[model samples]
Target: MASLTIRQLDKSYPLAKGARNLVLNKIDLTLHSNEFVSIVGASGCGKSTLLSIAAGLEEFDSGEVLVDDQPIQGPGIDRGVVFQSYTLLPWLTARQNIEFALKSAGYAHTERAEIAQQHLELVKLAHAADKWPAELSGGMQQRVAIARALSYRPKILLMDEPFGALDAMTRRQMQQLLLEIWETHRLTVMFVTHDIEEAIYLSDRVVVMKPAEIDQCIDIPIERPRDFSVTHHPDFLNIQSQIFERISQPLEHA
Candidate 1:
């Protein structure tokens, strides 16, 4: 488990022939060990950018990312990232893909296989372990991607729209799967998505981001081991409504 601190985080991109554009501004947030945090916002809200920076995939102009009071210098096993696109190797089977990550991480051959199988089972993809990415459906491919990410045993899982490519039904299944894994592993998770319902259903707290800044954060406060039944609960909609209100707020012109 790891705790995170982001203080005055800022990111900017240089224009083609002019001044740089500020993407993130003075963003400060904390994620406790084993906490599940979800971020939702508008299209250009820098949600993904923030996740990338936190994962050490991208650099920021200012501020710091600290884990367990230590600085995050670059991508490490402590932070695993899963993007919307399933970044699996088509030539490798699901089990093989996960094993490769373990091998690169310096796990012994016997240990690598054991860890790979364990994660595949965790994601309920054991049946498809032998199948190559091309043979798996979109959802199954993502399951393999998830299995690989988990095999590394990262303390924090940074997911950016990981289910955006799935159909509605598959999306629901994936959400439940993710929640189950999260509950079992108790890893710190920071997920970014545009779907309010998804954010509300899976997170301990929803961090709502505006175009250039974080707007508000709402605690879910619902009991854990969540499922589709959560949508029927009155409290669920109350949180959903709260998120909607934040999203619909108008941004003042710069």
Candidate 2:
């Protein structure tokens, strides 16, 4: 399988008095191609930082992160990122926002518009394509942001709490939307979320991270085209309970 491999990953930031705040230490993980992997842990367990390193936005002091056998160095079209806050450019309309990324990637004007529209439709935001970010609802803005990220057709989608700020109902809707997109696109996804149920519902494997290491990778064998109505099914509930138990543990002792 085409995969990502991380070995002995470590990162630390220098504090004011020459002290270093160790964030990640000896962290190792692997994500196969077309896999939906959810990472969950305490707030400061470096889950998001690990994704940053994978996306090449940050560097580790030691260790390796290789995607499909190549070492990651800097940001590239192969990796896409979506953050908690909808990072949309207020001045640009939804279509323009995606188009900007395409253009910056050196795509031609006609191709950029074509690809942007395609991705907007994929996220079900085609109708709001011409609307400015400020004019759209929070959900709509996030849809546009997701469209922009997928517009590049990146190999891996790196998400950091992309649905964290939405209301409960909207969050569920977005989660379903992501699953649908995954079904059709089959993009490798590395998602970071604090929501235990959401993590179990959307991931093929829920990776529980401890204070400075991964505790376990639990495979979710739930059948796809998942019905939200069956979210409380025995099997689903079992997986949810297991995840809840794991998530509730303190990272230091996990």
Candidate 3:
């Protein structure tokens, strides 16, 4: 079943003096259950805007977005979002951050602690459960963010470059961790990123977007249980080259 469906999605922002700036134009996309889909494009291409719309955090100018066939009107527990920034409360520890989400989700008090610790352990940060956001490393902070998002057990996970702020090494580690988590939980994920390799590495299919619409949708033929070593395979290099060439094209508005 399709977990999320977006059709004819057009989004614009009001400009000064009664003008409008179009950001997403007539876009159509669908994410199947347990699928990992990544949207990639240059800056100002509206990839993040698309993600925000999917998360119901932003409204679109026209069109319909559905989760499990029901139209999305606003933020709902059916979806969980993780942005590039580690949006944890500074006063809350790692576990507390997740517990807070659970509490807000109406989970029972006793169950909240158990679910929070389980998710922390899922992200391999159970040992750092008591650490504040400032006390954790960049990658660790993102892990906490992921754990918090998953604590609600949303049907779909929306990530907008959740690893963009980490160092190269840490980013790779997070990628592996994410893959493991996704496999374990069978999540339906829609991730947005500017990094082509990261998109290719983590996605089952890569959706390349231009300024306001999709340019291409390419499937990664690589087998699952993937690791960093797959990057050197011939098929991986070929697919990467094709996506790189597509993204290198000059934008119409540019």
> Which candidate number has the best TM-score?
3
The candidate maximizing lDDT is 3
* Candidates sorted on lDDT, descending: 3, 1, 2
Tens digits of per-residue lDDT, candidate 3, 51-110, equal: 999999998889999998899989877898999999999999999999999999899998
lDDT of each: 0.90, 0.89, 0.92
The deviation in Å at residue 5 for candidate 3 is 0.1
Instruction: Give the distance in Å from residue 81's predicted Cα in candidate 1 to where it truly belongs.
Output: 1.0
Per-residue CA lDDT of model 1 for 1-254, tens digit only, reads: 98888989999999988889999999999999999999998888899999999999999999988988899989888888899999998888999999998888778997987898898999898898899889999999988888888788888899999999999999999999998888888999999999999998999999999986988988998998787898989999988988888787776631
> What TM-score goes with each of the models?
0.96, 0.96, 0.97
- After TM-score superposition, the amount by which residue 159's alpha carbon in candidate 2 deviates from its true location, in angstroms, is 0.4
Residue 100 of candidate 1: its Cα lDDT?
90
- The number of residue pairs in model 2 that clash at the backbone is 0
lDDT tens digits, residues 1-254, model 2? 24778889999989998999998999888899999999988788889999999999998899999989899879988888999999998999999999999987778887998899899999998898999999998888998989999887788999999999999999999999999999988988999999888888899999988766787899988888786876888988898888778768765557
* Per-candidate total of colliding backbone pairs: 0, 0, 0
Better of 1 and 2 by TM-score: 1
Residue pairs in clash, model 3: none
